[model samples]
Target: MEHTGVVHKIIVAGIGPGNPDYLVPAACKAIAGAKALVGGRRALAQYAASDGAGQHIMAVTRDIEAVMAFIQEELHERDVVVMVSGDPGYYSLLDAIKRKFPSECIRVIPGISAMQLAFARMNLPWHDARLVSFHGRQPERSALLYQKGAVMGMLTDAKFTSRTIPLILMECGWPGEAKLHICTRLSYDDEKVVTIRLREAENYPEAKNGILLVEG
Candidate 1:
């Protein structure tokens, strides 16, 4: 839907692991020109300028309706940018945003996802990797994938942290001798990456955000 002659815009920008260096040029420019910024407190603090002139809205809840209303209200006046960590198209709020707003009203900018970086860090090509988001999802796998000797890249949240994921996989019939690579806080100052057997992953400490590279 058009906003009459106002021509307001909504940008769904991916900020990339909350690291300034990982911020793409387009995303950086979008934040600089944003009249209103919508994101979590940590993301805003990390990428946004301290003295920039923009109304910052904290989007901590899963209330898509509330976020949409705020964006629409802000768009009526000027352009609004919705900041999201990692790639917006990958298990992010992009789908909900698109559902709430019209195509003409939105612009999406991609960023380096942790999964992509994990593959890079491991010096592996990810063209054949099976991508999965275990965030807010129960661990499940297809029997066909198991038969094809697939490489899986999984995005992890608190509930499915690095340490607990291997246990879940073991229960799902995964072998204990499989190769497991855990990458946490990619591109950040305290980033950590470790390679271990699936059996050893149970003792590894968990991180708030991480990726698991599993090869069977």
Candidate 2:
């Protein structure tokens, strides 16, 4: 009974950005060997990700409970891989994964974040940058962007877009001279990056989803 009680670990692999080229070997290995796979549609779309051996748990806000239940049932059977976008450390599903499963039963494999890629695309260093997300969230902490020297990388959704973020910052007193880099569809063939001043954001093209970098 003691031998039978040993449960297989749940592997949480971070699938970087949108490109398969950024996937790390360890993450690929985990996905390839998974007996059960759980993640967003994009994450689960990998060729050998599910392999028809187990269930597909869609990692959406509405299906969270069902996803957890699916994972719990599969965790003890064999390899179970949970994929997340970017690194598990950032604004990803890692937090929910931790809440649903104990530390001992979970293992995280890191991958590149869009923020990291955005900074890279700008040919700038990001270790000193301030990162935040406005995706499906309110910009309540606008005060955090008040700093005079710190660079900022904001994840914007359709609602809080590149056009509005700059205005929001200016309303909060972030000066008009600050440089804004709109990095859209990063790592894709159609990926675009444009630089402008914070004041110019209103005139910039609308961005559905991407990072808006604020540099001093």
Candidate 3:
């Protein structure tokens, strides 16, 4: 619990989906001043400039142990900043890092999560909604949650997206009559929001870094 002289604490910051406007000032400042940056390939590309004068660790498909070791090494040399998509605390790598480091030796900077942006764009109230992410797990769970009429909000992957999600729902005996909202590339210039039913979504194209909102 005591973190004296532990200036090498891990800093987990969310950089939002893609829009710089949604990036918190504190997160931006941290990235701007960081001496080392660690994140997935997508996150690295979003904040490419941060690697100009710092060590950049692309954690694409790397094991969690590798990520933790990378962070540990960075902390020994300079101030390290781990950039994550959306809020770091939202099904991100922050938890794993925290488990390896003491709470007092970590700083978290929150950014606008994709779930919040998705609901906001749809003008829907999410207080009563259920949110889930298929980022690092099976998408089947999202389908099951959607069937329960929880106004499901999900972070989809390339392998499991709007196209595949609906198919899974149908196979799981979902009502098949719910409204589907595919919010893709949120907060970016190429943002797209497609509305369709469960059946129609089965044929929709897969999108990366997108959110699926299901309403009955």
My TM-score estimates for the predictions, one after another, are 0.89, 0.90, 0.82
lDDT of each: 0.80, 0.81, 0.78
In TM-score terms, which candidate is top? 2
Each candidate: RMSD: 2.4, 2.9, 3.3
What range of 10 consecutive residues in model 1 has the weakest lDDT sum? 139-148
Candidate 1 C-alpha lDDT tens digits along 41-94: 788777566776545565646777788788878887788898888899898888
Residue 24 alpha-carbon offset, candidate 3, angstroms: 0.6
lDDT of 3 by residue, 1-216 (tens): 233567776788899877889999999988777767787787677665743763566464559887777777677677678888789878878878777888877899998898999999999999988777666577445346434556878888877778876777666665678888999889989889988887777566676658998886
Off by over 4 Å in 3: 1-5, 45-63, 139-149, 171-173, 206-209
Order of all candidates by lDDT, from best down to worst?
Answer: 2, 1, 3
Per residue, candidate 2 scores C-alpha lDDT tens digits across 117-182 of 999999989888877888888657653557878788889898999998888888777889999999
State which candidate, 2 or 3, has the greater lDDT. 2
Model 3, residue 122: distance off in Å is: 0.3
